[model samples]
Target: MSIQGSALPARPYRAFLFDMDGTLLNSIAAAERVWSTWAERHGLDVAAFLKTIHGARAIDTITRQALPGVDPEKEAQWITEAELDDVDGVVAIPGAVEFLNGLPGDQWALVTSAPKALALRRLQAAGIKPPAVLVTAEDVARGKPDPACYVLGALRLGVPVQDCLIFEDATVGIRAGEAAGADVMVVTSTHLTPMVTAHACIDGYEHIHVQRDSDGLLYLQRLAS
Candidate 1:
């Protein structure tokens, strides 16, 4: 399905669950550069390989490739280290910092495929504060496309997964959020090509507003373009 610019529903979502790399910030350049180098080292097609890396754990991505003599765990660690050292082009998605800061600290969580250290480094580079409830690659046995991470994120925030809204920018993450029974909103800031998805999309958080009620429940409002 083609992406729709439809405003999200005005559900009284209890908490927000955000995907890090693309939804909260743009780290595409830094991430692709590191992955490209790794791909080249493994004699893999850089472009093709990069297409599969986003929204997935490094170890899972490497394990799927079945690269000869490559230890997925070790290679994943190397990738994480390289990513940690290369935050050159990382930047917040438009209005992301403000959007995040306005939310109640305990009412939001970050669910990311990047390991905790690398996730922290990228968030620092982008000027986004680390979320109180962070579910990183090491926190789950599986990654995006699997609901474990999102499930755990909502769990940690003390919210029911069904009462949370997930913001994501990749197919795998969208699927994960849906599988976890949360509503999904797509962030389109880093799209290299038009994305096709059934979820409502926002290019950035500039026009998205949040209001917290007296009961502390959150509601989202998107301004008309």
Candidate 2:
């Protein structure tokens, strides 16, 4: 369960990009509540429905699962409202605060599938103040696995895509960052097992440390297991 033995070596980069839901915010409990009701209404297998929600737009997931002829955006909006109201179990991922504090504010940004409003609420509920540069679902024409969101995030941060590192916790987000030509690291907090393909896997920021060089590159190192 620890990154002590088989973790990746220390690395450096110009900027760090992060995903919200599974990466920084641990809101699976709230999310499951919303999605459970949605799946029930649509007569979908709950387990399969949950898997499709990760790292994807709510509209996209709902449209794909809802019965034919349903207004996907409308259904997605209903789910979003439910999610916004169900902030009961929202919490920040372990070590996320310290990790963000250690990095220069301008050197990092957030990219998420949630709309800006929902993203703000969740971040605030988790006590992670929204950063200056946040790329939400509304920011891009497409979501994860398309590379558009991650690519836009890097552009907003004024960093070259290849010079950025992505911290994500879902299969789709990993694929997105990879497609954007950036190194990706998966956080093991949500998925204790390392199943996703990434450059490396980490438990959380607890075992990881960050330092910035005069050249404006951040160095990330993992503690001894």
The best candidate in terms of TM-score = 1
List runs of model 1 lying over 4 Å from the truth: none
For candidate 2, write residues 66-98 as lDDT tens digits.
488789889888988888888898888889988
- For 1-225, candidate 1 gives per-residue lDDT tens digits of 236866776789999999999999999999999999999999999988899999999999999999889999999999999998899989999999999989999999999999999999999999999988999999998888999999999889887999999999988999999999889999998887888887888898999889999999999998667
The Cα local distance difference test for each model comes to 0.91, 0.84
- CA lDDT, candidate 1, residue 224: 62
> For model 1, which pairs clash?
none
Q: At residue 218, what lDDT does model 2 achieve?
A: 90
Residue pairs clashing, model 2 = none
- Candidate 2 matches the true fold with a TM-score of 0.93
- TM-score each candidate: 0.97, 0.93
User: Which 10 consecutive residues of model 2 have the lowest summed lDDT?
Assistant: 1-10
lDDT of 2 at 46: 94
